[model samples]
Target: MSTERPRIVIAGGGLAGLSLSLALKQALGDAIEVAMCDPALKRDPHGDKRAYAIAASARRMLETLHIWDAVADKAQPIRDMVITDSRLQDPVRPTFLTFAGEVEEGEPFAHMVAGGDLTAALVESCRNAGVALMPTSVETFSAHPGGIDVVTNGGGITLRACLLVAADGARSRLREQAGISWISWPYRQSAIVATILHARDHEGRAVEHFLPAGPFAILPLKPETLPDGRIQHRSSIVWTERSEEVPHLLDAHTEDLLDELERRFGLQLGELSFETKPQAFPLSFGVARRFTAERLALLGDAAHVIHPIAGQGLNLGLHDAAALAEIVVEALRLGRDPGSADVLDDYERARRADITAMGLMTDGLNRLFSNDALPVRLVRDLGLGLVDRMPGLKKFFIREAAGLAGGTAPRLLRGEAL
Candidate 1:
């Protein structure tokens, strides 16, 4: 009905929000207006000491957006992965499964990138692409017949948009304001995340040790050379532990903490020391009852929060960005309302199954391995061993983990321009 370009307002500037803005602007040029609001955007991204595993498909989406090259040199390709299940006191932890890490020839399933680096790159890319970057966050919003009206808190700015996206994360205020019901439960486990500098190189290998408490992941990172010509190998640790035990671990003296870390890390990587202070995050599983309502849509943790057991949390959000971008771009190109119910429904349908499956899978895996029950341990280990022995099954899983197995993969994820 109207020939005016659609305005889309995103309520967060995290990875999902920033990437979505870049995708929309890069795809539609001046045909659409994209604005992202997040107070964190005003802060320096270098303070974030986290790292993420970027699936191959998500990497493709970033490449399509021309954002990957900025951080490519800093990314560490995961050449292989090893999984083991054992108790902390065990003298030897036997590997139950091993993955070659390549989903396609010469293409690793994933790469590890520092959070700050990726965020900085995305923010710069969004600005360079002409997407409006709002330093204030969306405090409230309401949908009207023509579009949605957004109100920013401290900025005192009221903006109108054809659509409003809630990327505010697991504790999304916008989702609540939109009357979206969220189902969630705490795992009573917290993951201690930190970067460790080791004497020997990791050789681009990632390892996951499933202990009675939870999965301890050692994700490889690109080696750093020191001033004295020493190569410093690094890895990002996601050590899951009982929730009540986290505070003690975090408050423990450096030597005490290092002792605990060494018990699980073993001597494979040589002496280990913290490259960053450890931070703990309480784990949880959450999903919205509906991904969209009228002109409102949920993205990233705003829609779902899955366990990081499989390291697929960020990948799922990137997939959402790609899918939503494609749907909106197509709808607008055809002269339809990008925020219309039909367009929103298309995005919901495309992502619902994938998100649900991943949520359930990670939840199940965490429950299965986060215990000392002999029966459960034997069963899961056997299952892992069996699957590890099946080349076809493992290959299929590799593709799935790379976010390239499904038929509904978006063009951006497929490394194609919108």
Candidate 2:
């Protein structure tokens, strides 16, 4: 073998790709050369329209990479999550289910973060780790048994390494180019998202209110400011709506949009108004049939995209980055080819079951709530109530929410940085 350290060329600069690079840097030290490719599209992250619920394990991973402290002040810990049927005749019915507990293993359930802030933090950490990030986009790639060669708009470079990763996301072109297939279907919904200045302080709580149309998620975020110079107490919104209504909703006036949003949100938040433009993303579930192929691997949205109802999408991907990094580092330490089929297979075996389970869980929840069939509704409602009544059972959920109840977790998310 050539005595050179293998080079890893990751396609996608989003959470997964950059994070993998950061994790790899921590895990392997100077034993690997890492390159991340993305368009680096210009956007004011401050004005971002997306937010994520970060599990406790995910937070520890950030800490290990030394990126958590950079954006620590921006995140709001989710002390509790209250889930309930929003259509009770009195509208004040007992929660169908409630999830609350520690942020870590013994910690709160999760942390709310603006997607842009998290991305910015990851990008900054990548720089600090000496991971070369290419601002240009990757237009194509070719994966071979020994290495993967990528052609980017910036130029063509042969990544002669043990592995290549597809962290590009649900529409992962690299996955396609590498001949990986996915079991995918549109959710037939669009999640309307925005930062809202709530009438009341969130008090570090989150809610997954099951409205008639879909789940309405209200997640807390650190206080922020609008462009007009007004301080705002912001909470993120994930209001799922029928696919057909999305465009009309987007075109609707601010007052009209808030009117629809307020009804589902109820009086709990008092009057609500948009602190930013409402953003809508088409929702879907995509699971790759395979995660490893020859010298290629997939992580984050590239591997699977579950329902946001569980708020586990990013957490799952972060774990993927962590696992793949560990596998590669171990392979290198053993003087084995990082891209060897055996090494890649181990990565696949470690991640497949969890990824598949999450996909099914999210899909099941969406199906359960999307319909109004009396029997199904009764059963699920009763199920939630039962869980709420059983504190012990509820704690199991709390652990799962924190991303600590699973297979061996990566060191970073364990509250120890990489």
Candidate 3:
């Protein structure tokens, strides 16, 4: 290893990559160096229109890194959540399960945050923490005994680091180059995401309607105030539909789109109008055969991509960031190489089971609800109803969803320093 302070290079600057950089710098201070590269960092921070349900543990990690305060005002806490199963044409959709979102005295299980806002906050935090935010993409890298040599796409800037992390997202070129096998299968569904301006407040309530195609999620967002002094009650919609029908829906007339949205949205929020153009994302489930190899480690979508049925994808990535940061920080503080096979193996071991469980859970949920089979519906509905009646089980599920159930949670996730 280099005689100077060990450096870690992250090959993406998305949520996971940025968070990992911030976490390492915050914990290790001047003892270690962190650099992150992603072309998206050079683009407008507000370009992303998606919103995410950040679980309680992820919020704690952000708080520990001093990032939560920057975005807190814009985050809408999920005070409650309701789940229903019904067909699109059904006049009545009965709620099969309901949850009061708090997992602790006053801490809600999750908060809905706009992707752009959170990303901007994280970027700022990384800058303030002294992380080298390179506005370039990693073109290639080669791991040797001492460290990994990373070459950037722009100007062939070569960076030598103690470790190279691939956070470049689901279609990671680095993962492919490293010969990491990816097991994946596409879903028959795609999610239509958009912002909805409703006439009434959401009251921090989130609703998930499981239709024949897939689950339609209405997640609350902080109300927006216009310059005209009007407060616009807003919510984000994740409308999952069959993949074959996405193009027609996207190209549909405004009136036609509104009509289609209303069919699933109902009239509970009074009037509804588009706050932004709807966008569709094809859904898929995938996991890397291995999370680590040589001095290279995968994070976020580079490691796995799960169904969005539970809104846990981003949170899972955050978990990866926290866990990896903790492991690397601890190893470095002990005078061990942070990128060594032993250190990387510790990270992989710490994260694999959690990732596997979440993948299977989301996949099973999507499969069980995204169909109209009578037998399956009856069994699943009965299960939901039974769980709803059991307060203990309900609380357990809420804690698990909040990422607070496991005792082995990383220090950062528990709102602690390394």
lDDT of 2 by residue, 103-212 (tens): 43546668887778888877777777889877777777666666767777766654555577878888888888888888989988888888888767888878887765
**Candidate 1 vs candidate 2: which has greater lDDT?**
1
Enumerate residue pairs that collide in model 3. none
Per-model lDDT: 0.93, 0.79, 0.94
Distance from true position, residue 166, model 3, in Å?
Answer: 0.2
* Tens digit of per-residue lDDT, candidate 3, span 243-311: 999999989999999999999998999899998999999999999999999899999999999999999
Q: How do the residues 1-418 of candidate 1 rate in per-residue lDDT, one tens digit apiece? A: 3677779999999898898999999989998899999999789977677999999999998998998999999999999999999999999999999999899899999999999999999999999999999889899998977889999997689988999999999999999999999999999999999999998989999999999999999999999888999888999999999999999999999999999999999899999999999999999999999999979999999999999999999999999999999999999989899888988999999999999999999999899999799998899999999999999999999898899886769999999999
lDDT comparing candidate 1 with the true structure: 0.93
TM-score of 2: 0.93
RMSD of candidates 1 onward, in order: 0.9, 2.3, 0.9
Candidate 1 lDDT at 295 equals 94
